[model samples]
Target: MTDLPAATAASSRPDGRASPGLRARLPFLIPLVVLAVVAAYFYVGLGRDPHVVPSVLINQPVPELALAPILGRDRGLTTADLKGEVSLLNVFGSWCVACRVEHPLLMAVAGQDLVPIHGVNWREPTPQAGPAWLARLGDPYTLVGADPDSRAAIALGVSGAPETFVIDRAGVIRYKHTGPITADDWERTLWPIIQKLRAE
Candidate 1:
């Protein structure tokens, strides 16, 4: 039988070399590259201070607040009550462990008579529980406003319990501090800001 022409051998590229098809699709990878960069940025940001949630309400007017009195309290609190002087508006709850953690510091601050400490009692199981908890823990607030529905808390942009806002004399929000305020946080950060706001 006549010999057939030698079969052509398939050419193979070197190892680690990409095929032309893959090279042609390189432009499709741009979006993935951008997504990876964005993901990396957020991952890095996650290591930052857990208590620092940047507030959009800073330097803005405090939201209109007219809340009913907490149970057993003679009077409720309002934004109007906060207008004449610099005050601390604290969002707290009976159920919040952090609120319990910060309670003593708040008492200390209240004892100093530096600023009037107002309360937004947020998401309590029963309205009376707030007053009861305060009665047991020693009430540190000048006035307590019941926010059982959390509508007022939402207006203030509260993420959770134990957040504090420093309001200026004109009822503008000057600063917001998330998480339970520690003694160091009070002495170093919050007290200074409150003093500065009072001076303004």
Candidate 2:
């Protein structure tokens, strides 16, 4: 006896049970909409953006100026001193809360001993106060420069304290960071640049 063939169900219903072509395309649109929302989120409201200050003398020879004696040292600091080695110039003052916030980071930077740090005490109440403060905490700066009048700071184009500049052996300003340091900043921005400069 011959067996009857099995009947297959229709793929689509003739009574319009399936969606139209445009309705089928709607699911594919979801990913695009999500991506656009993410892009707008980053572009408009994200606070973790990288600082992008334009450098006037970056990669160029650092300007020359003499800073007054630091921590009551007899000899003064000069541009010539910054020419021979890779160093970090940290602008700070005893009165700046942000500067206090970065003191520990500066200490950690000192622990690395990769390069020396020079503190430019900008417009401070007293030069002795800085050394005293460091003495209370720890002195990360190998040499500190007193710019109580901000003459040296103005020459370096520094607008405020808690700003740091990485100077190369050629006396060029390489990298700069404003505001307090963050863990992500250390991992992403500061360390990488320091490593690059160290290699060169």
Candidate 3:
């Protein structure tokens, strides 16, 4: 039988020193490094920030908006529909989980008579889903507009559902809330702001 060659001292690390050939394997570490970078990128932008939400509407007129009037009703909600009252323009959809969670807060808003609440149903897959969702949840909206295309949402810089934009009687967006409204927030933050705007 032919004798086979054994690993030399250079190839084997007896004293805890890897060979030069093994050092070349370090390049494979790049993938792990890349994954960490990508994870960090997403983590940083995870939370909501009003700065990123286009501030163009702040202290500016509400963008011109027209949407399918109403689900089965004669009236529709629009900028024109928003006339003569300080109100809340709630951007939501029936399918949105956050919107569902915020339902109680909305009902609370209604109870307080803080302001008229109008809904802008954004990018609803179907009109039926939106109205049905509202009907099931006990509709709080004074009027609802079907925005299946989300054009109005884009114009408002609405990144997600359950956002509340406060519009003055003059129809300018004054304050915006970016996530589900909480009990404390409805009282301490939102209600106070709405009252201030109303007073002004």
Candidate 4:
């Protein structure tokens, strides 16, 4: 009592607890550092190109694709149909706005008869929904199939509508495009890949 230690005097509160201000072990700082690290990680991630979607289907044989034809189409799609020619199999839905965005490009591809363009009408609300949408927009598919329950879509590893697969003449899946195709995409990437596949 006559002499309280100077170090203890400076560090203790009036109630005899160690003063938080004097303690370098700041319990409050852990969360702040964690928050800062998380923010930095997200900020760095934002700079990456979002269009790159990986698929296990690349270089693998196309999945079993027996599906009913969309309304007004004569024939359904089958795995055997995919063989004997290089083709583009587009997975689309009537409800997908992105498919609409990419439709004109597909129409152009079909109009030019560049190659066989097949359609997998994925997860349509009704059988007629795909047919009606195609009728209004103009059908561009060599063969169109309906996949209301996403059976074929899941086998093809489709994450969303407007995904396109580049299939080799042997019915192997060579490439998978995830989003709506632009003219630049066709010219720069898709067409080049198709041409290369055609050679092999």
Which one is best on lDDT? 4
- Could you tell me the lDDT of residue 93 within candidate 2? 83
Query: How high is the CA lDDT of each candidate model?
Result: 0.88, 0.78, 0.81, 0.91
What clash pairs does model 1 have?
none
Model 3 regions more than 4 Å off: 1-54
Q: Pick out the ten consecutive residues of candidate 2 with the lowest summed lDDT.
A: 1-10
Write the residue-wise lDDT of candidate 2 on 111-195 in tens digits: 9886788878788787678777778888788777788887888887777668888888888899888877776787798878877
* Clash tally for model 2: 0
TM-scores of all candidate predictions against the true structure? 0.77, 0.71, 0.72, 0.77
TM-score of 1: 0.77
Report the candidate with higher TM-score, 2 versus 3: 3
**Residues forming the 10-long window of minimal summed lDDT in candidate 1:** 1-10
Give Cα distance to truth, residue 132, candidate 3, Å.
0.7
lDDT of 4 by residue, 1-200 (tens): 53887877787866888776725667778899999999999999899766665998899999888999888878999999999989999999989999999999999999999989999999988788999998899999999888999899999988788899999999999998888999999999999999998897
Alpha carbon deviation, residue 195, candidate 4 (Å): 0.6
Looking at model 2, residue 165 earns an lDDT score of 86
Ranking by lDDT: 4, 1, 3, 2
Clash count, one per candidate: 0, 0, 0, 0
